[model samples]
Target: MSVLQRLLFARPAAAYPTHVPLTGLQQGALTVLSALGALASPRRADLVAAVGETSAGPALAALRRRMTLDPRGADILAERPRVTDALLRRAAALPPDTFGGAYAAFMGTRGFSADERPPVRFVADAELAYIVTRAREVHDFWHVLFGCHTNVQGEVALKAVEFLQTGLPMTALAVVAGELRLPAEQRAELNRTYLPWALQAGAQAADLMCIPYEKHLEDNLDELRRRYRIIIAPATAGAAARAGSPTPPLGAAPPGFEGLGPGVEGGTAAQLHETSGRLGPV
Candidate 1:
């Protein structure tokens, strides 16, 4: 492996005495924060700023309560194993267009494709990488569940859900950066269209964090969306692109793009949390 790969896959230099790591409940809390954080797109970070509103602290709590309390979005959460190379392989082998043709249509409309990041062939953490890998792989379904598309706003929403679900630092970064890209109006819309739903969905939905994402290919998208109470916006992105107008704020790309598609280049989640990517399990 290259030096960077070695480092990414290597164990932490030191054990974290206080890290406790996120237990299921703690992760659930972060899921709420991540969800709300994501919704404040173009200002996802601003959403993170909104995280501490004591009166609104219940966001995380709300997420936890929903996951523990409801039965809807939890089935997939059960089949998940900790992140592993084998799991990555399995996810990759499951299907090609499982992310849905809608995702592909979304990308084509934007004139971008995967090729942004080096392939994530190896899961960095033998122990925890499977979790991360699985988390990364299933991310698109999260988009499908929440009616998210590739826009600054959708990324924040998705990242927020990731935070609520996985508590990953990367998701936190996406949520924060996404907010910075938004205008005042978009932020307000997020609070209504995405955040409330995420709070409930992140909390009450089945444990997506633990599910085997590859197994859900035969499942129904509309049914899944209905189960999760997700909304689907019109594909306005294609229109904006055709107009030859200035790029619209956010919603510029398909949902879950960290610049990882076929021919797109340069951007990485590390470089821009408003990143881009293809709809693959990779």
Candidate 2:
């Protein structure tokens, strides 16, 4: 094939199945266009995915390498699991105190779907592509674990955490763009309250990508947080308290959660526990 033709229509290679390799120029062009689109309309998930995939080669490689060094991550690399609707269904069936239950509530209350995450296309290595896909898929799970809301301030703070965890250029860019768009008061709040918490929580938590989340679906959500050293933002905790669903005290896992599991009257207890502060507001 001619160079131009190859650049325009590169076939998938055996080593990078499902990948559509892009030339450096093409990748750079896509990055710029997608970044602009994403910045202009932050809700355009497709544009955000394009920017992430186009700019993620080096970061993905590094993440993949890191994953291979940990036993659970190595298992993930070998299995190449994809978060699917079936998994979400299973999560939805769990009790509210469980990790999967909280995740399902997080998605349900927000009207978000796991299928909405875009696929990885531009990275030329199969493992790297899988890593990118994994990162995208587990994003909401991160939100659940971190107690971040979908609001601008919360998203920006979570992006900082993501940047710390994955070192992805797209995440860094998102943080910068999010900060630029915030009002002065909110920006100050982010800088004062959320940013410091993100820095501490992101730096202290275990490598999230290595966790076998599917295996831990039945685990207690508070236990999972304790195991992962997750630090919930104070605002999130306060919100939970205001909603009359107080969280377990830091470093202590309380009993029963005030009848907050499944099968509660009207199912309001579960919903309140999940949305008020545990899984974060939609």
Candidate 3:
């Protein structure tokens, strides 16, 4: 075998059904090179996925263990549901106030495609591969839940939350690299406003991987956020407005949402406090 092949495929192929099995050195080199590529041009989703895949072994394993313990997450691992184009189309047809509807709007308004996210290639185990793929697919869902736009500020803020939630090294790198790309004032604004909110939200929210999003497509969006303890960052609301996709106002009780229950009208200060108290500590 050639030297490059030996380095890249040092391990036996039996363990990794979905990818080439690389040695530690090979994985590290790939991670560094891909990270540099992503840093130079954050729009390169391929490079970003490469960084995530090459650096994610330990983190993915930890996440898999956590998921195995949660009922919904465990079911998800067994069923292996994908965020397919058909699913997106179905979401697009739902009522505007529903979670799936909001996700459809977020993608349509920003011109993002469900197919844009690269598939997981480097993870060694089938389940871990699915975990990584699930994380990638649900990224836009995270955007809608947090009310974060697709701007640099919004992306960086969401990266902070992802890093905290998944312990993924690539997310931490993205947060740092993204911050460095911002101007002084924007960086300060991110730190002063979004970063704190992201940290708190990330730490307090439930295991998002546990959510069976497909089943909850019809659930009221605002109610979903409340149940999950997700507080949309104040800055995100304005950013969404500027992008001409103003967040559905809180406490909006348009007919159908009434069945979703009370507290949908407007998030009062007491309600916000109660949500925080319910989340308590991680």
Candidate 4:
């Protein structure tokens, strides 16, 4: 992490005691401040820190439980693998339609860097902290799986999916705040086309934290989505790609990014939360 970034997110050398286990009052204060910061400057590191610090605990527990229940997920937690910028760059060179290829292309085409995501600091348990950190790092992989663009519209749509899937306050906050900031046309598009799709997909898809994305980089992207019960919305680039067809070039504007399919709210998100609360130590 850069020196400035470290200061922004409280990444001190001691790592523990220096930053973890914040008081409830401190957390609440940080949450409001960070949410405001995120609203003011979306995607900035400091702002991401604000949201991340406040909303990570429950998510970590849920993800940790997910990792324990599934063998693949268990392997991932044991391995503690991290996806780095170098890894994404390497993956980008693979066949265009493969998972690694798509991930690389997505990052390359969108001018994003994996290193931009901040690390966890507030979650008290070290293992859970790692889970939260892993979750943040794999966010773009979720984008790849859902086939959402990095645009504000796409982000809000994806945030809806994440909110349903993870029940993270930050994602919910992002959806509400991001909607307010969007142009009328885009906001209408989200409510009319994408929100329902994201909610539905998030409700149906398997717990995303269980998937060891690093292991599937070479797999066919569309096949992977099917295995995960993910459906791309009809008439979008993701849908076209999943149907074994070509999509528009990345340089062109993205269509309604319904990468995750469309609609009934259900018990999956709640179930994950319930299960996480009852988990035994791994």
Candidate 5:
């Protein structure tokens, strides 16, 4: 990046477009710098900029291709569903076990808002912008499906899985950088319990970004997992702390991610409660 570009990105308050087009070299520069900024503060605007710059194009193409192959996925592409505040509000009123209800409950309990995700920027193509936009918007839904918390550990682990699933360089960078910053015990837990499960689950599950989550808010969470062929990893020790669950510590699981579906290995459930458990909203 030029000195002027660096100066422009240095101030988070600087106005940047929602769709700032950039060349390959400019995007690469932004990705490196923004990745550094994101590591320092995960919520930094520049970091979000890096993620959008690095991951948007290929992810859009991948989602487009995957959507083309599956009937439900194709319908999602045709309709271009979005997760909006009004939609989340409607989901909040759903029965507790439903996907939307669980998502609302997760957000409410964690004091997170559905509209907090940064808008897509730096991708000029309208359709590609929408694809990346959808990816960012539904990130929290991934947390709910995979039972990951918004904590450092949870976010890092989720990033690892996201890298595996989306082939996004930014997510891969996040996983490496985030893991290096974790405390020793938490880092050990990630390596021992989360990483393997995440890889397996991410690999086995359907292309999550292609799913029309907006259309299935009323569906049962477990049924959605089954439909998507998702296999959630074991919860970390922090799961209960985040959820404030009252279940026996030994066998407890998070509310929405609990219960084994047909595709889930029976042993995975046993492993979930055996480890220290953790889960919260993203």
Candidate 6:
């Protein structure tokens, strides 16, 4: 059997999987794909606008009825050519201490030390590729919106929601893989607290990827909560942190990433690892 398969099925005492290394070539490919995805999608800006228009139609219609009117969304609608490179560049220059910076560094700290995550060393071409990439970048905001910590149950809940919303295969993988981290009661709580909410919110709310998250960084969490009809499950915060227990300490400053301090406020530090091993970009 291959080393990875062994690592996958091996029993470890830590209650989570050990870190598995990836070869150099495999790493190179995913980076190329992420970059090419960022570049090749000449329609990226168009797709972003289109997704928002299509996905948010119902939400907008309802919003119009309940609230007087939102000229901001309409203004955004009037402006075509969504999310330009210039815009992304301006966004990058914004403080790294904010949520945006943490997202920018995902491929670095997020995947295994041995294998950098997407747009790192390889890339892929898929439908909704840019949308998928955007979803990955703002994953944490979803947590913040849900008032969730990085616990296994929360991750599973979000993944299940993503699966239902976008039908992304990777999200389904996350749902199944994340299940390994849950204890019996926590798993049950996941089913009760997060599952239905994820389905309803994911289906009902607008396509998050298309929404200009950067614009909302300073927006009141309460306002977002009210509009979306979401609940931050009060089941308890420790559940996710316990799952943070691991064998390999996350390596020192991840490469391909700028050192931004979460302490700096508005900047974020994101860490993504799993029981199976670190998630590689490839």
Considering every candidate listed, which one attains the maximal lDDT?
Answer: 2
- Which regions of candidate 5 deviate over 4 angstroms? 1-17, 23-25, 39-43, 236-282
Question: Across residues 1-282, which tens digit of lDDT does each residue of candidate 4 receive?
Answer: 666544455533434443555555666677788767756665355555656656666766776786788888898789888878888878877786677887887767656677755556666576776666666677778777777755556666777887787776666766776667666776787798889888888999988877888888899877888899885553465556665664423322332233323321223221121111111000
RMSD of each: 12.4, 7.9, 10.1, 10.0, 9.2, 16.9
Local accuracy of candidate 3 as per-residue lDDT tens digits, 54-101: 778788889999999999999999999988778989988888788988
The backbone clash count of each candidate, in order, is 62, 0, 3, 2, 9, 20
Q: Give the TM-score of candidate 2.
A: 0.79
The pairs that clash in candidate 4 are 197-262, 231-261
> Among all windows of ten consecutive residues in candidate 6, which has the lowest summed lDDT?
259-268
Q: Model 6 segments beyond 4 Å from truth? A: 1-117, 120-128, 234-282
- What Cα-based lDDT does every candidate model obtain? 0.42, 0.69, 0.68, 0.63, 0.61, 0.40
Q: Is candidate 1 or candidate 5 better by lDDT?
A: 5
All candidates in order of TM-score, best leading: 2, 3, 4, 5, 1, 6
**Quick one: how many clashes does candidate 6 have?**
20
| Structural similarity to truth (TM-score) of each candidate | 0.46, 0.79, 0.78, 0.75, 0.73, 0.44
> What is the lDDT, from 0 to 100, of the residue 71 in candidate 3?
97
Of candidates 5 and 4, the better by lDDT: 4
Tens digits of lDDT, candidate 1, 1-282:
667655444444322222223333434455576556545442343233222221122333344454445453244334433333343434333333343433333434554332322222222223233333344445545654444555555566666666666554545555555455556677677666666655655666655654444445444444554554443332332333555632222233443332211111233222233332232211
Q: TM-score of model 3 relative to the true fold?
A: 0.78
Better of 3 and 6 by TM-score: 3
Angstrom error of the Cα, residue 76, model 4: value is 2.0
Model 6 C-alpha lDDT versus the unseen true structure: 0.40
